[model samples]
Every structure is written in C-alpha cells, then in structure tokens.
Target chain A: MIDKQVRTVAEALEGLQDGAAIMISGFGEAGVPAELIDGVVAQGACDLTIISNNAGTGDVGIAALIGAGRVRKVICSYPRMVGSRHFEERYRAGELELELVPQGNLAARIQAAGSGLGAIFTPTGYGTKLAEGKETREIDGRQYVLEYPIQADVALVKAYKADRWGNLVYRKAARNFGPIMAMAGKTTIVQVEDIDPLGTLDPETVVTPGIFVDRIVRIADAGKAAA
Target chain B: MSAADTIQRLDKQQLARRVARDIPEGAYVNLGIGLPTQVANYLDTAGDYFLHSENGILGMGPAPDEDHIDWDLINAGKQPVTLLNGGCFFHHGDSFSMMRGGHIDICVMGAYQVSTRGDLANWHTGDPDAIPAVGGAMDLAIGAKQVFVMMNLLTKTGESKLVEHCTYPLTGLGCVSRIYSELGVIDLGPDGAKVVEMVDNLTLEHLREMTGVDLTMAQ
Candidate 1:
C-alpha cells in the first residue's frame, strides 16, 4: 500500500494514465478538490473520460481537463453552465463526448457501483425520448427502467480532514460524491485540507474509511499562502 | 387579472394547489427537491402526470408511503420519495440527458429570484459556508419545455426575490417562460414582465409595493 502523501499536484497525479476513466467528486464548486483538479491540468493529462455531476466552470475542475484538450468523454448531467466557450466549441465540434446522467441517478449509479450492485430500475425518465432503445421490463404491471453500473480506474475526492490511516471526513456538499466514488474506484485518492494522526479521528465521524482510500495527499492552505 | 391584484394573501401550500391545477393529463413532470416538491401532494397522479424525482425514479405520485419509505430510492435532495406503479430506475447519466437533452415536458422548481428577463437564481444564498448544491435545477430549468417557479416573493431578510436583474448567482439565464407566485402568475416577456393572473383581491399597486422590481399587468 502506498501509505505516503505526495507533496505536489504533479507528484499526486503521477499514477494516472491517459485514457483513464476518472471520477471526480464535486457539486458545482463546493466539494471539488480544487488542488487535485489544478494538478490534473498542470500535469497535462489528456484523452480522459471524466465522470462528475457538473463541470465546474471552464477554468476549474473537469473543465480544466476540457480546456487542456485532455478530456474525451464527460459523464455528467450539465456541461453548458460550467464548460467554457472552448468546451462548448469542442462539444459542438465533436472534439468531446458527453454522457448525460440525471443528478440523482448519477449519485445512485456511483453508489450502486460502489455497493457492488449490477444495476437498478427507476422510472425517472421513461416513455419519452430518454427511453430510446433502452431495455424495458415490466415489474408488477408497471414498467421499470434498468440502468447499469458505473465504475472507474481512479476517483479523486476532496475531504475536509483525514487521519493518517486514510479515514476521511467531509464538510457540507463536498461529501456527496466522495464516499460513493471511493467505493466505485479501483484506486481512490483523497485530497484533504488537514491531515491528523491515526486514531485521532472519532470513529463515528469517519466518512470514508482507510479501506476505501488508496492514497492521501495533504494540501497546505492555498488561500492564506504567501505568493 | 391585473398587476394590481397580484398576490393577495396565500401561503406556499396554497400556491402549490394552484400549481397542481395545471397538471395536464398524462404530462410528465419532475418536482424540484425543495418547496416546489410540495406540489406532488396536491396533484392527482395516481395513473397520469408521472412525477419524476431527479434522484432517478419516475411514475412518481407523491411522497413515499410514510409507513414504508425507502432511503435508497430518495430524490436529489436525499428525501425519501415513492414511486407510482411502473416506476423504474436507471443510470443517472441517462436521466440527466433526459433533463438537459430536453425530453421531460415540464419541471416545477423553486427559485431564489426570477428576473423580468426570465433568468432563474436559485441553489445559492451567497453564504460561503453554505453547501453549493444545484442538484438538477439548472438542467431541469432549461431542459424542460415549460419551467414553473414556486417561491416566496421575498427573502427572510424581506428583500424582494423578483428583480429587474439577478443580484445573486443564477442557475439559468432567460429560461423561464412563466411564474406562479402567491400573488399570481406573471408571464415573462421581451419587455420585462407582465402580470397575467392575480389573486382574487390584490392589485398591481399592491404587487409593486410588495415586489422588488417594477410591475406591469397585461392590458
């Protein structure tokens, strides 16, 4: 196990390869791992498939990858709001692929993948254009739609604090996609603002246990740092 | 109704009943996670008007059976929601496309502010410590053919939420076509906004007095 913490975003991204299906945790800008996203951009990783809720505007998060010309497919629900003009141009020019998911279903898919469930049935958008070509089954005289699993090679999550054992605790909306993706990824990396000693974290507060986290990277306070 | 008789006196639930009256037979709608979600209780969706919860379940009729709620099948806000007969679940990716891709017919949502230009501001109150979660509001606001807003005219601070321009963050720009308030229904148009319907006893002056922006009623 890589029990070490990386010093730089570049060092933190050393394990990610091109074409990797990476799941990023965030809702708008709240829970996004700003440092990790900056690292992905700085590392110049390309041809990536990013799974996220919404692309934090073009200058941040998955949008940076979209800007770096590194992203291939985006499995997200909303792109136009955040993706910059460059992203829009790419999407319209066929430079990028978009896989839209409902916000709730996106969370569930991530959770479902994490929970080891093969699939689930929801009637969210059925009998409309969204149901095009999907396999439909009748359960109890009502039609339920089936959605498959969502797994990825790596997942980047931001947590407020983490213990040396890699247990994580998130503050606010940052917690939404983090824990779910932790279980869904082959290698889950956490970027946290604070790192504490092992056993220091209250057991009840452990949002993502060490078993789900493969690595830890601590971020020095970016806002207060001297230029 | 004139702009004068905009909002007389009504509560959010009362407004929900007015919104419920508009549910057409067999139309599909996704009630946004917050106050707009209360509309589900007033509509008769037993067999029609499929209610969709952004968290990925349809055939939605009302809140989950209080006696048998399932946390796993909750909506975007993690509130327990129930499925009507024939309801199913799918990958969230597909469901969002249905939203952004413009497959759903209507989406009832809550707004912090709606501009005369029809811009929608919701999901953020500018509190840095507050969670910035816009689950499916923007997608639903723009994707659905018709967007209905259910909101209080003023914030707790007593500021008018409807404005000439949005001072807060926006979920979508110029996406709303009409609005239903405790006062009445105001249709967004090219020349600012016009009051199309009002509560039985209010007037345009009363609406302007209680609103954050200038008011106009359709002649």
Candidate 2:
C-alpha cells in the first residue's frame, strides 16, 4: 500500500531537526498549517529558518513559533504585518535575521526549486535595492534580475482535503503556496481536514500530486478551529 | 482670498472615483492596499472588470458582510472578501505569474513619492525604527501593464510628493505611467509630467508651484 497517511502531527513532523529550512505555506493567516506549526513547537526543534509570504499575525502559527525563539531567520517577501510584534521584537533585538525578496521573486524562486531549474531572470526587483547584489542581464531590450531557487528541508502545508495516496486539494484563496511548497520541500508534510479513500479524488482536480507529498495527517477540527 | 482658501482639492473618495473612471472596460486590475483599495468601490460594476488580488483570487468581489465573512477567502490585505461568479483560486506561483507575466492590465497603488520621470517610491521610507515590509509592491509596480498611482499631491507638512526626484528608496525605475492625486491627474512620459486635469479653481501655475516640478497641459 502506498499510504502516506500519518496518525498524528508528531508522526508527520518526525525527523525535523534544528537548523532545517522549512517552508510554511500560507499568505497571511489563510492556508497556514497551524496544527503542524504547533506540533513543531512541541517537537522542540530550534534554529529553524522559515520561508513564507508573511512573517505572521497575532500569537499563533508562525508568530507563535517565532515568539518561542525557535526561529533563527526568516526569508519572506513581507515579514511585517499588523500583529507581527513577535517577529519585530526579535528582529530589532538582533535575535532573528531576515532576507526580504520581492513577492514575485519569492514565489518564482520556490517554483524554480520545485521545477528543478538552475535560475530565473525576472523583471521584478530589477533596478531596485532588492536586486542590489544580484546579477542582471538585458533580454530582448528589457532588464531582468537573476534569482536563484529556494529549497527547503521540510514544507508544512494546510489543505482542504487529501486522499490516502496524498493527492491534495485546497479551498479558495487558502490554496496559496501549498502546491509549490509541496514540490520544493525534501519532506513535505500536510495537515488536511479530510483524508479520502484511495481513488476517491479525481486525478484531474488534484492540485498537489502524491509524489510531492511525503506525509499526510488529518486535523479533523482544523477548519472549525481556524474559523 | 488666500492661496489655500482659493484652492480646491478632491477628497479621498472623489480621487478614488476619478481614478476609477479611467480604467478601461474588460481590464484585469489589481488594487493595492490602503488608498488604492477604495477604487474598487468606484469601479463601474456594469463594466466587465476583473479584480485580481495577489493572494490568489481572480474575479474578486467587494468586502463581504459580517454574516458571510470567511477567513480563508480573503484579499491580499487580509480583509474578508467575496469571490464573484467565475472566480477561481490558485497557488502563489501562478498568482504571481499572472502579475509578472504581463497578464494584468492595470494596477492602482498608493505612493509616497513620484518623480517627473515616473520613478516610484513607496515601499520603504528608510526609517531606522520602521520595519520594512515590501510585500508585493515591487512586483505590482513593475508587473502591471499600466501602473497608476494614487496619492496626495503634498504631505501634511506641505512638502510636494510630486518632486523633481524621489528622495526615498525607489520601488521601480520609471514604472509609473499615471498619477491621480488630490490636486489633479497627471501623466508621465519622456516629455515629463503632463497635467491631465485639475480640481476647480486650481490653476496650472499654482499646481506647478505646489508640485515643485514642471508640468505641461495634456494635448
């Protein structure tokens, strides 16, 4: 049986070590794998490097992880939000490091890693401070900055549903970053609301194929908890 | 009458409506957070305009009522929004591709400063105490086909935001195509800033003095 289903968040988070580069899939609060992140906190892995679109808001998910002093650095497009006091405090106190990339570049870099590309030339961030140290080239009369791939040791994803074989589908705008993070992570662990039986999910609608996902754990009440 | 007393400036809603009127029909638009988001309310609902939120929604609708709010379905600003009919969602990679790939027609954004050459400065003020968060500003600045900026012509201290050159960090070089401000609408090109229209009682000479940049009447 090719079952990727795990019984608990702890089982899904196994082998996550200190200093691991983990991608937390989300855009702000939506699509964030809060249960998995809470599991990571309980698992006691420190010095983690987190990659996401936003640092986190309020005292939950990434913000809680950062507040716990478990993260050493964050590589994201936007690390500041209304309730992101935890990240701000650590950054100002010199406890956490930040690598800010343009939003498009951030998505492209992760996609490049997943797609197994060497590098990409993008118009975003060209002729700006974000591209200050990056290489530049003119392509067909347009300037582009060279951006490299961003890989991760682990990816924590939240999905609406998944099959036993790990085929995943997401809901609405909450789908952001889940598919690409699934591909880029060496070990992608997903927290889903429901795990359907094998062959129940139509292959045509599968957003993240089972090949990219390593572990699946169903947090049955996650949808209600997040609400 | 004093110069201040004689001048007329558009309120935020009026400026938003003014900017909204210029959006072409059937265009795909991205409204940046803050002042630019207000333009959505002023857009012609009868027109076939698709609102793109960088958070992976297309055909995005206005803010949902409190009873229908869903936390998962939100805009880039993290505000609750409704998805219109034919709306769809995708992952971040595809969402940004639509922006950076030149598929979006227009993007309205708020800016701190704009130069005569259409240079944009809004992401960072270089304040040591301020936490710099670029978000998708740089991408939207350079990605959209037509970058329309909405801002006040002058700061509260009376400093001109339309300047000879931007003193703050540049978001993108010469990416802004037009600007809609409280004082008037202006277009930028190789010839420099051209005044499209001004509020009632606002003279070109006075507007020039207020902007601190050379302005020509649009042909």
RMSD of each: 13.4, 1.4
Please, what are the lDDT tens digits per residue for candidate 1 over residues B1-219?
555444365688898998888878787788876687888778864447777655445675455556665434456655555666677654344466667667888888888888988888775676654324445665576678788888777667767878998877676667787788877888885688889888777777877887857778877
DockQ of each: 0.07, 0.75
| Clashes per candidate, residues 3 or more apart or on different chains | 28, 0
State the fnat of candidate 2 relative to the true structure.
Answer: 0.86
The Cα local distance difference test for each model comes to 0.72, 0.91
Query: Candidate 2 chain B, which ten residues in sequence have the lowest lDDT sum?
Result: B1-10
Docking class of 2: medium
Q: What is the DockQ score, from 0 to 1, of model 2?
A: 0.75
| Candidate 1 positional error at B178, Å | 16
State the lDDT of candidate 2 residue by residue for B56-171, as single tens digits. 99999998887788989999889999989988898889889998889999999989899988999999997878888898999988889999999998999999998888989899
Q: Please, what is the TM-score per model?
A: 0.57, 0.98
* lDDT accuracy of residue A145 in candidate 1: 62
lDDT of 1 by residue, A99-149 (tens): 766565577678778888989775443432334588878878755568887
Candidate 2 TM-score versus the reference: 0.98
User: TM-score winner among the candidates?
Assistant: 2
